[model samples]
Target: MSKPVLIAGPTASGKSALALALAQKTGGVVINTDSMQVYRDLHIITARPTPDEEAVVPHRLYGHVDAAVNFSAGAWVTDAAKVLADARAQGRLPIFAGGSGLYFKALTRGLSAVPPIAAEVREDVRARLERDGVEALHAELAVRDPASADRLKPRDRTRIARALEVVEATGRSLTDWHREGLPPLLPPGEFAALFIAPERDALYARIDARFDAMLAGGALDEVASLASRNLDPLLPAMKAHGVPALIRHLKGEITREAAAETGRADTRHYAKRQFTWFRHQLPEFEWVMPGDARGWVASVIPGREANPESRDSGSGPSDHPGMTWS
Candidate 1:
């Protein structure tokens, strides 16, 4: 089998389409590297691969976790390890695709060996965060784990609470845990990595349009169901690109148009961050334009002759409606 493929890009940059095409051509399994797409409640809001698209090929780690779980990159690694083993045992090439920089980083570069914090400790930190606020928590963290407090922003509720939880659960600071990290799963040379880089204006346009499309595609309803659960606001699923804004709309806190605009703007900003993160944090990824991605994949992937149709102006299999491999 050919080397596994790693596809990373900003939201709505067509990374999913390229991955689906490659998986179809190589009989590979597409594993989700996106953080939001893992939550079952975020299928629409997160632009996760639809059930129909998933039916076309093997997909792992999509919509498998509940919205209540504060799923971490470390948790994803544990889950991904099993999926990777299963793919290798079945002799299927593995294609990791998504825009999550941390997940991709954890896959290629080792992650810190932080043990899971006990549920009570996590709940206590979260409760204290709600009662005492993030600044107070940051102050506490500064007293407990000075390095982590200094490293993390004062208002970064998630990281601040996490660091406090680590210190509370284990006497060691997060910095000490980072000194010992788990090895990368794929390692260097085991996978061919590509970051789909679309032109800035074009990418922003697509992100705005995709956000509108997602809203029409029952994203608001999905968010409503999730909000009804009254899950912790700090949970990753609750913080998905459009989820918070849509939840506000559902609660009549904003107009539908206002919510859409906020969601679109948030997504656009996130896309910009994704580009920066992949460029600086994961420099090894060869950046390819969306239109050129198929050709690049065709050249790197083996087993079948490079499909000329992929290089043509004609359409190819789409991972979702309005998304296609160019």
Candidate 2:
């Protein structure tokens, strides 16, 4: 694998900007890892880079999905592998960038061997949950797979239901399949990845401000355009962070102001969750301030060495706080 610079951070953290800078410097391809940005009609709302910015540097996997399909991290990693392979074959660096933590994790650590649930099984589980309530499903899951149930909150219907549904359809617990040992996708030795850890209060302010800007920039109209297409509301694309609230506003179910406020709040909450996930699950990534893109990137990639202490023989980070400077 060719060395790829991963520019990751919370929402509104200038990850895309940093990625473009690195791409321009290194003749790389900027691959989108954000789950929302994959939705085709969500360019402005997902803040997909402008054409001029894209023209300055090649980008892959942004605004390419129809809202009807639920795009998964597993699917994203598969797509990203092709982009990375292409970039390497062309002797160009691959710039992996986005706020979606799962996509990045899948790219680095690989996903579990969980099969896609059959449509009927999925619909049946969803209907059962809706009819029987979260607690009922929670108890059932506890009886079936106590490990996953213990880890999940009883009210975290999104995941708890998924765990139960997987067990029901596959006749194997999701946790059991997870332990079945899937092979690495990229493996740790392949590339350099970074996680941008911004100060919390500042990140919140940026989140609120960006949501306002997104609204001013026709996020409502974008959602309206998507809604006009009549894509299933339950689809992952339609349920993107700001899409639901904006769609509600468009449907006259909520005032525009209320919708925007809820969207901003949701983004802020998601940013918090993203940080927690990265810090806890993937501590191997070098943490960097977004402002030092050029120097930090130069320090880690290829021949240049920034911090002698963190670098290894192959491309991997040390058990420390900065880039590997081989």
Candidate 3:
């Protein structure tokens, strides 16, 4: 069987395009590794593959969950394991693609086995954090779960609240559950992975242009519908890169122009963070610039030509011999 392909990159870095091209050539199925794209309500805002793209190649796990659901990395890993097995059984390559570093990491490495916390528990912790402030919560965590407190910053409201919730709900520190993690779905030496790295300035330009295009493509209406639902503001979908800003505009807190600018800035900052996270957390993935990714992927897959015409032109495989796929 061919090795499964994993394509990870920052937003607007052409990850989906690369996945689609390779899948078309290899008879593969594209599986989503993006956190935002999983929401059914976020098709346009998340830049999900359109129906036309999905019709070209088999796609799995895209827009499968509701925006109100608190989908976690562990949940995605479980879903992905089933999809990976089905694809392998059918003799099709599984092309995992997206920019969510944590989701990708969970697939390639084991994830913490923290059990689900009740909605009430999560809401209570969030409420306490808001009422008593993060520092107060940090102090409480320091007393209850000092191990977590010592590792978390006082200003880290999310982590602080999470630690408190786990301790409160399960009577164990978050670090304890982390020590007992689920095995990796795709362990080392089992998959071929690549991270797309584009020129910083060019990437920023694409991000800006894409945000403008999203605004034109009814992203505002999408956010407006989501805002009307009165879902929890802390849900991941609610805080998607542009959602909060667009919601602010809908609430008359900001002008449309200002919302668009804020969304653009937020996406650029997120792209920068993705670059850093993947570099530091997933060092094993081979990094290729946008122009070279297609050649790099083709080179790693057996019986595939990087460029068919080059075979007769007296040119050899693209000079990316440093990367090896097992």
Candidate 4:
């Protein structure tokens, strides 16, 4: 079985650069495992590899979807499987890189066979999510499936809503389906993995600086362009880190500074969660400083270089922090 090297870490930790260097040396194909970068319209805000970066290496699944469409973890996993198959078939090494931990988990361990909820079920859950707080929804979920509730916090609206939706739709608990035994697509020993970790203070600094850089690097303009489309304010794209604040700013409801502050705070919180996820959920990955990634690559990759075509664009599907939906 062919397995790819997976590189994951908190945002702005330089994981992407390491992946590039490793891919360049290994001749691997960079496949995006990030949910945000999949949307073609989110290029700048998502920090997709720029045109110059993509030109330097071969990248797959970058900007393949329209921003208007909502994408699920299941969809991302399906797309990722295809990307892996294609890369392997072409005799190319596959490099999976992203900040989305759930995506990685879903790919490595097949998702629970709990199928998608019916539309009616989804609407019912959504109504509950709106009328009652996520805590209340989670409380209901806890009553239905105590085991699942035990594993999740009350504020984890996305999972809580999903779990409840599944129970309502199929009369089965999400946790029970998980207990039904889903095996790993590639066994643990089949691949090498790395999680880039910058020092805490430094990581926060980088997150701040990166957000500022993103604003200066046309992220605001990207938001402006998206705002012009007049899409639903509740759409996933509209809710991305800087997108909501920018929308509020554009609506004259808040000052640019206020929006920036909120955006920065949100990003920081997200980075914190990411660090926690990599530390706890992905214990098997080698945790190394971004500066040490080249060494890890040298030790594990054995001199491989992905084609230069994919690196021209500094942005790709896997370039951003892909978050789950509410």
lDDT of each: 0.86, 0.77, 0.86, 0.75
lDDT of 4 by residue, 94-188 (tens): 88888888878886766766676667777778777888889898888889988888889879777787788888998989877877754555567
lDDT of 2 by residue, 166-262 (tens): 8988999988888865555578777788877777897788888878887888888888899898864556777778888888888889998999888
> Which numbered prediction scores highest in TM-score against the true structure?
1
Off by over 4 Å in 4: 1-3, 131-156, 227-236, 303-326
* Worst ten in a row by lDDT for model 4: 317-326
Candidate 1 per-residue lDDT, tens place, 1-326, comes to: 68888999999988788787777666678999999999988898888887767876789999999988889999999999999999889877789999999999999998999998888999999999999999999999999999999999999999999899999998999999999999999899898999988888988888888888888888888888898999999988889987888888988999999999999999999999998998899999999887778878878874464234323323345743333432
Residue-level lDDT of model 3, residues 1-326, one tens digit each, is: 67889999889888888887777666778999999999999998888888777876778999999999988998999899999999988878899999999998999898999999999999999898888999999999999999999999889877888899999999999889999989998899999999999889988998898888888999999999999999887788998989999999999999999999999999999999999999999999999998788778987796853333212222112212222222
TM-scores of all candidate predictions against the true structure: 0.94, 0.85, 0.91, 0.83
Q: Which stretches of candidate 2 lie over 4 Å from their true place?
A: 228-234, 302-326
Which is better, 1 or 3, measured by TM-score?
Answer: 1
Candidate 1: worst-modelled 10 consecutive residues by lDDT? 306-315
Which candidate model has the greater lDDT, 2 or 3? 3
Backbone clashes in model 1? 0
In the order shown, the candidates' Cα RMSDs to the true structure are 3.3, 7.0, 5.6, 5.6
Model 2 accuracy (lDDT, Cα): 0.77
Candidate 4 C-alpha error for residue 110, in Å: 3.1
lDDT of 3 at 106: 93
